[model samples]
Target chain A: MPKHTIISVSDLNGALKDVVEDTFSDLWVEGEVSNFKAHTSGHLYFSLKDHQSQISCALWQFNRKYLFFTPRDGMKVLAHGALSLYPPRGTYSFVVKSMRPAGEGDLNLAFEALKQKLAAEGLFSTHKKQKLPRYPQRIGVITSETGAAIQDILRVIQYRFPMVHVLLIPVMVQGPGAAEEIARAIYQFNAQSDPIDVLLIGRGGGSIEDLWAFNEEVVARAIYHSTIPIISAVGHETDVTIADFVADVRAATPSNAAELATPDQREVLQIIANLRYTIKNRTLRKLEVEQERLRNLRGSYALNRPRMMLEEQLRRLIEIKRQLLRTTQLQVQQARTSLQLREGQLQQLDPNAPLKRGYVQVFRDQTLLLRANETHPQQLLTLRFLDGSVAVVVNEVSQDR
Target chain B: MSQRLSEHTFSEAIQSLEQIVRTLEQPVPLEEALSLYEEGLSLAHFCEARLQEAQLRIEKLSLQPSEVHPSTL
Candidate 1:
């Protein structure tokens, strides 16, 4: 029933695709980017729009590496690509092969200019930078709490050094108001009476413009004046910002910043263990030395000649005392026997015994004479027996052999 | 003297332990060495006790959008 030549939707789209692609291939289409989205495949999807109309654009990941700047919404850019068609939808889009920043600004130039100015002012001077604390107690982090920078930092820090206290002063890390917010955060931390040992100010990997806050003069100046040592970690490893130069130290990324901020607990524990071992060894050696000295002193006592001689002399004195005791015991036994014999003899000759046996003694003139020649005149005489006595005045004595 | 050592932190304990080891290396009198050995062992224990801790405390402060003070800038 169709009068004209009939074509399927796909056929017409394919025909149009070839025509449009051939004509518009490799042309410079100038427009403002809008509704931009980065797909997980490293491909960029966005709409380049003007006051009148908008066109969908796709910059594949391969082409994106050549881009001088990240194409954001409202950013003017000169995109080089060819038109393409999605046959199913019968729609056309620009497949951008290469792109560059255009109009109103160049981030690279601005970065260089600011860097020179700050360098001239000695903001990045090595002398001005403070040394980082070997062991940081509290680390003040100035970044977006919801960003990858915070997460990466926390994960790394928790792994390497979990004892550290992380104080996050959340701030805008992108677009408008990010620079001033970051600068104010630095000042706020500095104003505290108990300031943090170090400050980690940064964001995750981004385009230069996304990390533009770190390049701002205010942030650089704030870093320069901060009393607390600052570590600036902005964007990817290749992305260097002015804050990196002005900070006391610059890290390759957010995770690296956390690494630099802390001393590894493993190494610290090893050090402590080593010290314990060393002290134990040293103390044992000291005790051994003392023991050796005591042993030496004991050995020297055994070799002392005067002490040995005194010991020998004491042994002889003991022997001499034993001999003296034996001799004295024998002498006492003999003396007892001799005394017994003498006692028997003396008893036999006792005067009292003789009196009891009927013997008497006579006295004349108060004297007893054994000789007859001894005569007394008118002298008192006495005779004594066992129990009786008599008195007389006579003198007669007999001499007996 | 022993209270002070117990109260020392890991940093202080390690420093003092190092010093004690240095003193112990020399030939000290037995009475002095014995006391130093006691102190060194205690300091090492203090350092060990500190290693058992690994608590991560995170405090996040909120900031209003554009709450920056420009005058400081």
Candidate 2:
């Protein structure tokens, strides 16, 4: 094509703006951010630069709301949008729809990569998590010595369980070599002959860069390999680190880690006091039951009416004795009457009664006067009369009718 | 009763005390109940003493000459 003669400057600039906008539109450019400015109208103007090249970029508030993080000068970013040009200024610029920190994006990518690798290795599995000691006698803390994290942890532990022994293994929680230091602290705790019951490793809240040590693969591996139960309290409540996934327990803050380490002594005391009260009450109830049994026995008739029971037995014995005595007296009286009747009958049959009627009994050895025919002369006889005895001679024999 | 209460820790003492309390709740003979009550009282005393006398002791591990890693400082 032949070049046109006498073209206006405005026309040239307008043509260039259309060509630049149509060609470089909807492309991603990578560079370090410079002269970053945010106007009060919620619009951003910045320059994307490299070692040998530079371009201007603008972001509207509508698009800025989609950014995950705020952009700053000297930060490497990947800006996505169209190349825009202004006719009046005769300048070409990139209209940014979105921007990201290249370094942070890489860190985030690495974070995701490591998380997937560890998760596949079963480091974040629930079964791999060691059960935290319900009552930890000794607590091993791995954190910065002079940080507010240590102060917060110590305060919570002292308030909750004063009896716990806190062993602070001061370690660099951030910056270079922090991951190695944290990992070594864990190993050191495990190497001891008498390891602590639980380990609390954490630092206060900060940016992802500041808290990057916790997300390191070395720190995650160390936490996974810990023989003692580990509680990870790495950042604020909203922040989650890789260490949290590998630890046995994940606490939202440093103070929360201390709370999870040991049980509250005050709560324990209250439980013990309740137990004591229950025991005393149970014992008293036992005594009451026993007393009730004793009272029943005491009020029984056998114990209270000993005399009455004996009196009843005594009355029965007396009645039996009286009946025996009456029977014996009747037998004696009947025997006496029979003896007297027999005596009367015997007395009437006596031969002395005939003698009392004046009859006489004669003996015949010397002659008897009862018969005359049987007597011989010159015989003497003796006779028995009622009142006297007489002697007689029989001269004649006579028969009396 | 074989384990001396004084030798037990606060947790152990509390556990034994709770056991005694549970036994007492059952229908036991008077003599046995009396003995259990005595044991519970002793263990309760031990737990209270432990809770009252316990103090917080914080021990800082000495930094090695070559491995002095002060993070925030």
Q: Per-residue lDDT tens digits of candidate 2, residues A181-264?
A: 898788778777765889999999998878978987667877888899999999899989999999999999999999988788
TM-score, model 2 to reference: 0.55
Winning model by TM-score: 2
The model with the greatest DockQ is 2
Q: Is the docking of candidate 1 incorrect, acceptable, medium or high quality?
A: acceptable
Off by over 4 Å in 1: A1-105, A296-401, B1-8, B22-36, B63-73
Q: Give the TM-score of chain A in candidate 2.
A: 0.51
- Per-model RMSD to reference: 19.4, 16.5
Error of 2 at A237 (Å): 0.1
Under CAPRI classification, how is model 2 graded?
A: acceptable
State interface RMSD in Å for all models. 3.5, 4.5
lDDT of each: 0.80, 0.82
